[model samples]
Target: MSYPSLAPYIQKRPWLMRWMRPLSEWYFDNAGYRKLGLRADDLIPEEDEMVQLALKRLSPKEAYDRVFRMRRAFQDYPYLSPLVKEVMAEQTEREDLESMVINKRKAAGEKKAH
Candidate 1:
């Protein structure tokens, strides 16, 4: 990709530029770039509050349609590849670490009871 061609994508997502530059060069030199993952991942909602409000007022399909169209409009926006579920799992692990600390404190208290 020419510097000019890649400018917009880089501006939109600065983090990717570090990886994208090399990826693009290899893709162009070896073969034409293939478009993959067009529908592989789930798209996120633009506004959770707005979506919930509309869901109450409209039919389920209609509510979903509104959300889908908004996401489709900004599909060009950069997003992390991993799902939010994975991020939530990491968060739960952090909570478990805190719980372990609390449990250890309780165990110490119980030992002192005697």
Candidate 2:
């Protein structure tokens, strides 16, 4: 799963958020994605199966818009970030579970062989 972020903690403190807002804005602006007509989420790699599944789940209009943005950015997308994050988290969890199961099965098989 995606590591826990400090973002929520920082955001919950009004003073910290206020202090960080300008710096965050500056960072975002300078990141250059906007110049490429891409949102921060658009930079996420789509090679993951989770990402592909999330793309498939997008609404038709949203999917069309995402494609258009990607084409524009190539010359890139709101629900996208949350959806991507959720998928990534799920994928990680699944991987972890699969590894645990495999390890258990391997250990059991080794015991049987011995």
Candidate 3:
């Protein structure tokens, strides 16, 4: 079967999907390491689970608040570890938007005034 076919199968079989998390993790850990990879490290769990884990270890509201706070701070965390410096370099580089829009508009205004 192809990947597209598996989507509906997994959706229709929630129990099967739940059971396959470990297998999926294993597949991601090896061949798919960069993306579907980092199985153990990428386990963000879910909102409710984070809340429950937080409540169990801390307080109910505290856990909820902490989860959201962490999410806002580190949601891009998965890519940051490897891509932080690279992303910073890109952000500082020449702006495509500036070249296309600002320069074009300036030329157009000059032509109109002439």
Best by TM-score: 2
lDDT of 1 by residue, 12-99 (tens): 8878887787886786556421232222112334257764564578777866765575566457455554667789989999989878
Query: Which whole-number lDDT from 0 to 100 does residue 14 have in model 1?
Result: 72
- On TM-score, the stronger of 1 and 3 is 3
Tens digits of per-residue lDDT for model 3 on 2-113?
Answer: 1244757886898998988788778766654344223332344545655456457765776566556656545444655569888776766656545665444466446565
RMSD of 1: 13.3
> Residues 1-114, candidate 2, lDDT per residue (tens digit)?
254778999989999999999998899889876776677667667888788898899999988888888897665334368999999999999989888843334554465644
In model 1, the worst 10-residue window by lDDT is 32-41
Candidate with the larger TM-score of 2 and 3:
2
**TM-scores of the models, in the given order?**
0.24, 0.53, 0.27
Clashing residue pairs found in predicted model 2: 69-76, 73-76
The CA lDDT at 70 in model 2 is 85
Error of 3 at 20 (Å): 6.5
In model 3, the runs with Cα more than 4 Å from the true position are 1-25, 31-46, 49-79, 96-114
Question: All models: lDDT?
Answer: 0.58, 0.79, 0.58
**Model number with the top lDDT:** 2
Model 3 residue 97 lDDT score: 43
Error of 2 at 72 (Å): 1.6
